[model samples]
Target: MSTRLPALITHLAHRHVSVPGLLHSGFGGTEIDQAHRDVLDHLAHAVTAERHRVDEAAQTVMRGATTVIQALSHQMRSKIDEMQHRYDDPGLAQHLLGLDHLNEQNLRHIQGTGVLCGAWPGLTHADSHLGDIVAGAQSRIRGYHRVQVTSQMEAPVAVVARAVEPIAITVAELLANALHHTHGTLAIDVSLHQAESGACVVIDDAGVGMHSDETEFASRLLSGQRTILLTELGDPPRTGFAKISRLMRQYGFSVSIDKSSPYGGVRAVVFIPGNLLTLLDEHTHPMSAMAPLPRPTSPTRTGTLPTGDAGGTGGTGEGLPRRRRRDAQPAGHLPAARPDQAPTPEETQATWSAFQAGTASGRAASRTDHLEGNH
Candidate 1:
């Protein structure tokens, strides 16, 4: 029996372990305790072995991800170099203009598919197109205009694409505004830094800066103000500022406009949340094997149809009562709105209609146009 017990333990240890089954045998007090101890030791060793295996697998996965990203970056850099060298070619400008169309197609695809993994390729392609455009534009607009750029933290291709697209758009708008509104030498200084909260990208322009009050108003509008103030200067036109504001809001980032700048121009500070940077970082360390958090569900909308009448109950037909009867309700319970501020049926209908009209108009005009040809 003694000899058989060792053999049994050895066999069970090599095979699948069942601690309870191992302890269940004809044995005395000491033997029973020893068997229990052996079972526990086997389990601990198995757990350690499994954990080591998992760690090695994770490391391998991470190495693979790093390799893929490095290769993608190398290819992009090589292509950009080739394009830079071809800049002087007589037909280079025309070819880049053609690539601009391809850039638009890639952007549209990214929007439709929501495939962020393809972001670098799409962005690098678009960057090449823009680089050509910038070169062409510079030849004509090159006077005393100043441009400075600084960046920190290795930017992943995907991050570069997502970050640069909106920035370029905003900068283009600013440049156009400066060219038309301001005179004399214009300069732009851009800096990117990593903060404890997140990454911050600042752009400063030495053009005719906005007035103090106007800058404050613009700052407020950028910080989640849906309705912009139309100043006594008359309608400011929604061509540039309004569009920039809308895009910034959609991206869940904060944009601030300040009257102060070293160059005596308007300063724009864009705070990029670390989440996007983290996504790029994860791509660098994909072997973690930990699943990312699910995206939060967007808020549900009350799709109430527009209807007339001040306080009639049947408007929109979903049985949402227009009035809250205090007597019919439980004591101390309150409705979401105060009795005075509660929107009247007419007001609600008018507001909803306006919103719907604006939404339709925005969608129709949102198709991005990359203006070609030098000014």
Candidate 2:
């Protein structure tokens, strides 16, 4: 009877261990096992609920941090704008421009964080030309000079007011990624193509292309099929693709980065559907009436300098008067000036002087307009 009792206890112990496996495999067992499975299911659900709560808490903390940074950046930018106005010396003007550019890059990072936390792009502008939108994006990054934009639209294409900022942010992130991966003075080619269905902004780089796995991961992220946590972004946190994904899902546009570039690098294409597009004249607002676009500046080395840096010469070097002409050119076509006929130094200096004068005049006009509007 003692031996039989020991065997019975061992049988009961083995049955208890099998309950969890039965629950996992969705199998039914003895009534006692079923009761054990019910308890285990409840515990599992509790754990999942706790994990969700923690994720929400972490996102809340990140959103709060981004909000604080954004407010500080706005005040700093206002001060920089005032300084830009107070100074007329070319060298000082250049330095002020660099500061402004740096602030813009900082703002991009902050805005990206906010967006990933389910916040809007935060600035609203009147409907704007697609070319201008692309140029506006080009002005935001560290390697603006390396970007060569060519537009092939038969007519002007403008983004609807609702989509303007989100598209610009996506393009800027793409340009930054291209700049980070490419080396030397190789040009990053950005081409705009318009079709009956929509308009596409195609960015091609000259760096080594992504591996199959990297491409697959990027495809999944851009598709917005998977939920991403900030913790999953890896050390130092790359929020670019994640931010782009959020914007893509929220807005109706789509992005594809799965293709290879002719330049032996990755090719990324952003397509804005016809529903989100308009003519330049449609729903247009006065420049002063709309949220001000980022003022064009001479490209300076802002943000982390990617490996194989291009000497950051897209515009005048750091601490130089802002040159709006180079970047402000319409994205639809290349400059008419022949490459062989480079402007003489005297001609270049004259152009710079004219640019500075125009900038001052424009500011004065804007102030006057504001006063008149108030009256």
Candidate 3:
């Protein structure tokens, strides 16, 4: 009887350790009863079911909160747009632009939260150029000036209407992650490449790369193979990868961060399948496109910041176009320029004016479309 008693206690101890795990992993009460019918198994099953219920309730709350935030953000953006048009003062306009940028970032956060909580990315009825989408995503983040984009596609590629916002959100999250991990002055390189089966937006940063374990975890999250719970995300929870995973499951695109960058950082690639791609006719006008913030008007190469008084042409250093610091010259001195080798200030001013005019036209067209749709 003593030997049998020892064996029985050991068996109970094993069950004690394993039952909670199995129940938490979704083992039903009936399944547990079939294996070992006992009061402990029943209690564990009830506890796990309650825990799942609480998680669902929390997710619903999160979704509702994000929905409210998103609506508010949209209203704020519309007001800002109105103010931008009402004020002609360059100084005030610059401040408004900065405010608009911040509001965009806020909207991104809210959208990401909504996605993680099972809400869809906001609806868009018009298709957007893929390059413009990436540019728009870059503008949504804080380090927009530090990103250098190089597009290598032979022709313009546009994302379908339904997938536009999801792709933008995913790229923005990846860019934000890259920017967050990197330190000051390091540029993020974004290159768009055409793949045989689809197109890829590749982002690379010079920040410290992820460890193997971290990479593996991110891969699992991005793969959508494992279910993710908001409770599992740490304090000030990181929902970027999880949001990307959810979007991938809903949308048809795929993202990968397992590759290392040439800059010794992370190389994140977002591949949009051919089914989601449509060719943009050269003569077609943009439709409800999200315009990228105007880049600093400075004579500098990609990934390099401009130096002294980069406000372009006759512009004062008092607005969003103002550039603060100068970059060092390259090693070899250039030969003296021919008479018309570089663009004259007048020419630069004309180019800048054209760009502004085009942006205003796009905005006006978008507003007209919105009004027409309402009718």
Candidate 4:
């Protein structure tokens, strides 16, 4: 028997109050009574039944739709690849091949959804370096060219096989979020740091950051119990953060956003607990401190910060200089290319050529002054 039951009943009896209406009737109960227990039990059972029905229907429909979408994305990618190979004009081929990359992104999104909704297959992998996973994720983002990767993780250390891709996927989603929200011209810095125990991957972007309330909501979503229903998502759905949240819960990692960034933008930090990491080389000592990788060229050709007011077109600036793009013409003729913007024929050709030739390695902008962008 509940210890408080007799007291609660006695108190309610003295007050001449019905327990069922205690809450809505504006008379709060200090203890639990039989009526309260019965009411809570009945509501719990009803909610459980309703929740099961809703989850079943949502999963069935979403899984079916995403599967169809996945099939189409694959077919589209094959045709785009074929077209890229056939075209002699570099510009035309570039235009056609851009579709292929977008298709791949779509496929990843669907697979992420499948993982979330309980349709995707089990995670599979062999041991891979944390740096390699970071590279894989950077390669998948839309504005990969604008991202700079700095890793102290060197070749000798590796994430345990089981945690590699999930970590990669979570990092990619964070990068995608940064790129999507910022002007494509801005630099996004992704850095890797090794803890004495685990590791951390931090992504900093020069995008409009989220509000406090938004952060709270996102925090709850990321760290909450895995009891969410599909219906709770928005109409078209926003699965980027949600997808990562699910993975973090399942795979034993932690994620936090906008903790620290020099650019006044969003900073996403992923904490990989020590349990998920291992040293690949038996002889080589894993560095407790980070070592810098080769830095990539800045946004400007001259590597001088562009001339603009702090609060002007782009955003914040502390006056660290960077050169302008060599290829960019006047502001009239030169439209700023963004990740979400459809690529022009010429731009596509240039990017595709870089990808094909394998000389297109981009760096993450880890420096603090590079945080702000030029208009």
TM-score of each: 0.36, 0.68, 0.69, 0.64
Candidate number with greatest lDDT: 3
Q: Rank the candidates by lDDT, best first.
A: 3, 2, 4, 1
Candidate 2 lDDT over 251-356, as tens digits, reads 9899999557876788999999877876533223222211122233324333211112112222222332221222345433332313345455455445344433
lDDT of 1 by residue, 1-375 (tens): 344445545554343433244334565457776766676577667765665566456544433453444444434434543563456443453354334333333333322121111112122212111121222222222221244333432221122334444544444444444444444343455444445545555655666788776675566556655432222113443334554565566555566777676656666676655443332222222211111121122244222222132123333323331221112223222213122354444554443333223222222222222112110
Runs in model 1 lying further than 4 Å from the true structure: 1-146, 152-164, 175-184, 228-238, 279-375
Q: Give the Å error, residue 38, model 2.
A: 6.1
Return the clash pairs for model 3, or none.
307-326
Cα lDDT of model 4 by residue, 47-69, tens digit = 66776797878887777676666
Ten-residue segment with the worst summed lDDT in candidate 2?
A: 366-375
Per candidate, the number of residue pairs that clash is: 1, 3, 1, 13
- Residue 327 lDDT in model 1? 23
Q: After superposition, how far is residue 375 of candidate 4 from its true place, in Å?
A: 46
Judged by lDDT against the true structure, how good is candidate 2?
A: 0.65
How large an RMSD does model 2 have?
14.0
TM-score winner among the candidates? 3
Better of 2 and 4 by TM-score: 2
lDDT of 3 at 15: 32
